[model samples]
Target: FYKHMLGRKVIPADLEAFDPEYFSNLKWMLDHDITNIVELYFSAESDELGQQKVVDLKPNGRALPVTNDNKHEYIQLMSEHKMTNSVRQQIDAFLKGLHEIVPPELLSLFDDKELE
Candidate 1:
C-alpha cells in the first residue's frame, strides 16, 4: 500500500532515509484511516522532528473520507491501549492546529475523541 500509494518502491534504505515521500505516505495513511497499523508505523518513525515533518506534509483542504470498513474496530483498539504522553501530546497539538483550519462541516471527521 505504501509503495502503491506513494508511487515509489520502498527499499530497505528508505526506512532510514526519512525522505519527504516516506513521511507523505505516513500522512496519507493517517488521513485515509485512523488505524492501529497507521499509529504503529507513525510511532516507530516518530521523533520530535519527524513528527513535525509528517504534520507539515499532511494534505491541506477537506479531510479524506474514512474508507476502512473496520475503522470503528480500529478506533476501539486504539482507545483500549494507552498512548505514551509524548504521542498524546503530539496528537493533541496536531488536532488543535487542524481544527483551526479545517472546515466546520469537516471538523467531525477529525474529532479528537475518535482518534484517541
Candidate 2:
C-alpha cells in the first residue's frame, strides 16, 4: 500500500536518486563532520587539561620570518590543535621574521589563549 512514495517518484528507489554523486559527496561530508567533532572533543579535552597542546618544531629560534615552509608548518599545527586565525597569523608572521628577530615566548604571550 505504501510503496507509493517510490511508485509516485516522491523518493527515488535507488540511493543515487537521493543524490546522483552520493558516495563521493557522502564521504567528503562525513570526513568534514568527523574532523569538526574531533576538534570539538580535543578542545574540551584541552580545557580539562588546563593547557593548550604545543608542538615545538624549532629549537632555540629567534624572530623568524613567516616563510612558505613555516606557513605550512603553522597550518599543520593549526589543524592539529584547532588554532585560531589570529594566533595562526601571529605565529606565521613570527616564523616569517624569525631569522631576523627573536620571538617572544609565545606561550607566555598567549597566556593560555591561542586562536583556533
Candidate 3:
C-alpha cells in the first residue's frame, strides 16, 4: 500500500537485484559526506530547450546535510519523496481516472502490488 514504508533494498536479501558494482557505488556514497547527494532534489527536463526544473521535495530538511546517524531517516524521506510526494498530482490524477473506470472502494480492497 502507498501508506506502507517502501523497502530499503540495501539489505543482503535484495542483493539479487544488484550487481557487485552497484554495491560498491553505494558503499562509496556511504563513506563520503552527504553533500554527494545534493542532486537528490526532484527535477525534470524543462520545456525551455535544455534547462532543468527542480521541484523541492519538502518545505524543510533539504537545507541540512545528512549525517551517518540520520542517514536512515534521509533514505526513508527520499523514498517517500520519490514515490509519492514528488508525483502527488499525477498519482491523484491517475487514481481519479482509475476510480472512474473501476470503483475505488473495490480497488482499495487490494494492495497496490496486487492491483498492479
lDDT for every model? 0.37, 0.33, 0.48
Could you give the candidate ranking by TM-score, starting with the highest? 3, 1, 2
Q: Root-mean-square deviation of each candidate, in angstroms?
A: 16.2, 23.7, 6.8
Q: What are the per-residue Cα lDDT tens digits for candidate 3 across 89-108? A: 67677767766887756655
Q: Distance from true position, residue 86, model 1, in Å?
A: 5.6
Candidate 1 lDDT tens digits, 45-90: 2357455332211233113323356443333332222232225565
Minimal lDDT window, size 10, model 2 = 1-10
The clash count of every prediction, one per candidate, is 0, 22, 0
How far off is residue 21 in model 1, in Å? 23
Task: Kindly list the per-residue Cα lDDT of model 2 for residues 14-97, writing each as its tens digit.
Answer: 323334564344334333433323221111122324565433333422233334334444333323332322144555555566
Name the weakest run of 10 consecutive residues (lDDT summed) in model 3.
4-13
> In terms of TM-score, which candidate is strongest?
3
Model 2 lDDT, residue 83, Cα:
32
Put the candidates in lDDT order, highest first.
3, 1, 2
